[model samples]
Target: MAGRAGDRAPKARRIRLGNREVVTEGLELSFWADISHRCMTASWPAFIGGAALVFIVFNGFFALLYWFGDQPISNVPRGAYIDYLYFSIETLSTAGYGDMHPQSHYGHFIAAVELFTGIFSMSLMTGLIFARFSRPSARLLFADNPVISTHEGRQTLMIRLANERHNIIANATAQLWVFKSGVSKEGVPYRRFYDLPLIRSQSPALALSWTVFHVIDEASPLHGLDAAGLKAANVGLGLMVSGYDDVAAQTVHARKSYEHDQIRFGHRYVEILRVTEDGLRIDYSRFHETVEG
Candidate 1:
């Protein structure tokens, strides 16, 4: 009689063919990868590598023992190394169900070391997992306040900046990077970005308007930039800001990102520098689903 395919011991699960480990499937893999990355985040790689090497060494040693029919070399009923390996692993993992117990002194010693290693390694892994999950994802939104403003008795293409988080990240210092694009004698677009000097850094608590004075004077390249030209000319703004937290002595967490679509220009001009002043602030929590621009 021929055996069914399911009874074929040689034909194992398909996962064995791939870079997949049976134990590290599904949620386990996700959890382990995150933990591994975090553990190795600032030198987490070395530790994880070492752990892998140790695991390999122990696994290979036991497999060889099982193949060779080695004994416990004591008054212990030495089972095959395969039994020792399985029993050791179970004991080390603290799943002591008493299905198999060490009968020899040599077997007992091996079990002790494995149990110790398991406890230490598991505690370390757990710490890494906690830190990784506790850490927040860093993402932020910042848009230049206004393009045109009243400066030195002239309507200038000024850029203003401020922190958006109302109650979060107090005393956050903000920096602005501006990129201006224009065509030279060849009429091809030329671009340059510069860090703007702020009188006082961005602190959410300040509630002060920080202005980047781009003097669009007669001699300035920005002077001839009409509404359409200004749009066509293309100017980009970037902000990088950080602040010290006295309470935490370290920043609890932080997030920042640059986006241009947030800067909106309407055909109707409101003579206001700050969006909050003009009641045009962005809520950012929800979308209206129908945005004109």
Candidate 2:
């Protein structure tokens, strides 16, 4: 008897699962299943969706049985359609409510399959929920706003961005670009772009928001530039930065020129900033180390 029960175990388990893939088919039933499968591997969703479509169509086969099975179609059985729909729902939920029992052997077989289908559906939904929540959504931390100040005779632009986990860059290089109005051969309105190299380098620290500066130098097209000139030019500054901690990703951003009046010349301005727990803090006073040519 024990051996017989043990032999029944696999079939019982199989009944509870149907085809593991079958439960994940159909838009209504497959919604959660698709989520879980995509969380597992890329190929699973296409397979799951296709499989669900097949399963739903197969359910329609059962519907056809109700509509035109061997059962008498001229005079419909009282409450029989309701009974089938209710049974389908109960079986699909593994509710085993027992309020409605399948009358025929065919009906019993269908109920058993649906009961198992529900079991697998529940398991896959659980897996997908956990997988989605468990995976980290990497974040990008930028400063509250751009800072504007004057350096020498020209206006400047600055912003602070920190690698909170110190993963974005270990020794990344950044190139500054600007698009502004410049006369061209077309004689029509023109916006020209140019690259500006930082006089200094990115710091060795990782978790800190280094104060990046863009001074409109005399050599620059931005040199002797003012807000109206920039407005006429329709200017924006782009930074192309690469090199980051191998563990995390890095991004590039474009910040625009500060208004000429917004900047204070020959004065260094300080802004409050925070750092990640794992890494370092910044000291712009060090950037002051540049010796005059």
The most accurate candidate by lDDT is 2
Question: Per-residue lDDT for 79-158 in model 2, tens only?
Answer: 46654555555566566576556666665566566667667866766676566555443333444444445555556655
| Window of ten residues with lowest summed lDDT in model 1 | 284-293
- The clash numbers for all candidates, in the given order, read 5, 6
Best by TM-score: 1
lDDT of 1: 0.50
How high is the lDDT of residue 160 in model 1? 43
TM-score for each model: 0.44, 0.43
lDDT of 1 by residue, 1-293 (tens): 77786763342333321122343222223445575564545455676686677666765564354334345423224545556666555665678767566555665666677678778877976787677555543233333234454545665543443334333455666565655776788887787866655445555542333334445466555456555655565655555645544433445433232323334332112223436757765443321111221
